[model samples]
Target: MAVIPVALAGRSYEVRVGSGLLADVAGQCGKLLRKQRVPIVTDSNVAGLWRDTVATSLEAAGKEPRWLVLDPGEGAKSWRVLERVMDWLLDEEVERGDHILALGGGVIGDLTGFAASIMKRGCGFVQLPTTLLAQVDSSVGGKTAINTSAGKNLVGAFHQPGLVLADLATLDTLPVRETRAGYAEVIKYGILGDRAFFDWCETEGPKVMAGDKAAQDYAVTESVKAKARIVAEDERETTGARALLNLGHTFGHALEAETGFSDRLLHGEGVALGMVLAARYSARRGYISEADGERVVAAIGASGLPISIAALGMDADGRKLANHMLHDKKMDSGTLPFVLLRGVGEAFLDKQVALDDIAHFLDEQLKTA
Candidate 1:
């Protein structure tokens, strides 16, 4: 087992990564596990896969377990679902001292954490992230939210969890596509500030997706470690260091909105393609060489991620897509800051980018896409 700490002073917590941590959730959270029953909020898909093992573990540890299974998907991150979860937690009589377990992927984790944050002003909760996306990124950070009609994560909080249990074994049940989607976040770590790691991923990513245990462990650990360091330095993103994590997110979130936030394009896939756009745009602006931009495109394409918006059958033009970003959470004072690359392993935030220029560049891109 490897434990990576997110040092947030009074809000510090540990992200535990291992093969079978889920089966020992109760043991790991001994003191947090009270005589009262623990309430776990999950999605239908995940409930069928690992609920029994989790409940069995808590039961053996002399803790009672209560389950609330939700419908799975991006839609679940809405006001309606959030209300449902809040009502359920209140009905369960969860207290500020009780640990509400978020026992699924990012959707469940985000929803549960948001609920716990507002329940009686604030409460304790644990994150048991099942999907690779959740384990590597969402579960570790304190960013919790429900999607708003205006944009993704527009309605959320900065509530950190008490602990995070990331069991690689649970990924065995993931569909090949979901596994590949999660790999995109792993790739972001390299694109943001680690060229050597990027090279390593270029060679080892396929194997990791193919279920190579060692490779999977290495990827998750390295990604979490990178995030932990950044979060420690700039916990609330006031220093701009934490904003570097949004490498492909600005463009990616626009794609997500254009697609109506459906399965037509997964978050990570949009990110994979968004990274390509960022690289290309960076080269266009003379911040990086075209060769370097192509290198990023080649790496992402080889990983089986989308390289072109045209291929995805998106009908929205660059102007329309750029309009969507107007509501991005990263926008400040009517100026949208973009995480653009200076080269591989180097990214900077540019708040001076004109939306019109971006639309024109994207229009040219669409011609060949």
Candidate 2:
């Protein structure tokens, strides 16, 4: 087991990555499980797979497990479901000192964390991230949010988890498509800052997706370590340091909105394609050579993730897609700062990005093969 600390002053926590953490859920959580009745929020899919393991673990520890299983999907991260979760927690008589367990993918973690953040003016929560995307990215970061009609993750808060148990065993049940999508975020850590890690990914990415345990462990642990370092430096995204983490998110969120945030494009899929766009756009702006932009596209494409917006089969044009970014949460004083690449491992924030120029460039991209 690899235990990486998210050093956040008084609220620091550990993100443990390994196999069978879920089997020892009670022992892993330790003192965080303070009450006899432990409140756990998860999606029905996750409950079907690992509920018994968690239940048995807590039960063996003399704790009664209380389960609130939600419908699984992006739709669950909404105002309506949040109200339901909040009401359920209320019925459980949860107090501010109580730690709620979020036992699923990013959706469960985000919604449960958001609920805990506002519950009695901030309670504690632990993240049992089941999916690769959640374990590597969302679970460690304190950014919890629900998607509003205006945009994805429009309603949320920065509520850090007390503990994060990323059990690698859970990845065994993930579909190949989901695993490939999750690889997008895995590669993202490399693309944003570490050229060495990016090189490592270029060769070993296939091994990670193939479910090789050693590869999976290295990928998850390294990604978490990078996130922990960045997040510790800028907890609330007040500094531009945290914004680097959004390397592909701005463009990715726009693609998500254009697709109605449905199964047509998973979040990680959008991010994979978004990074390609960011790289290509960076080349257009002369920040990087065309060959380097193609390098980014090739690496993402080799992993079987979508590398082009043209392939999405959307009826929308560049103007429509660019317009969707208008509601982006990152928009400041009518200018949206973009995370563009200076080189493979050099990402910088460009606040001078114009939506109009983006529309024109996207129009060109839309017409391509």
Best candidate, lDDT: 2
Collision pairs in model 2:
none
On TM-score, the leading prediction is 2
lDDT, candidate 1, at 159 = 92
- Could you give me the TM-score of model 1 versus the true structure? 0.99
Q: In order, what lDDT does every prediction score?
A: 0.91, 0.95
lDDT by residue for model 1 (1-369), tens = 999999998999999999989898889888887755989999999999999999999999878899999999989999999999899989989889888999988888998999999999999999999999999899988999999989999988899999999999998999988888899999899988999999999999998789998999999999999999999999888899999999889999999999999999998898888899999999999999999999999999888888888887778799999999999988889999999999999999988899999999888877776
- List ranges where model 2 is wrong by over 4 Å: none
Minimum summed lDDT over a 10-residue window in model 2 is located at 360-369
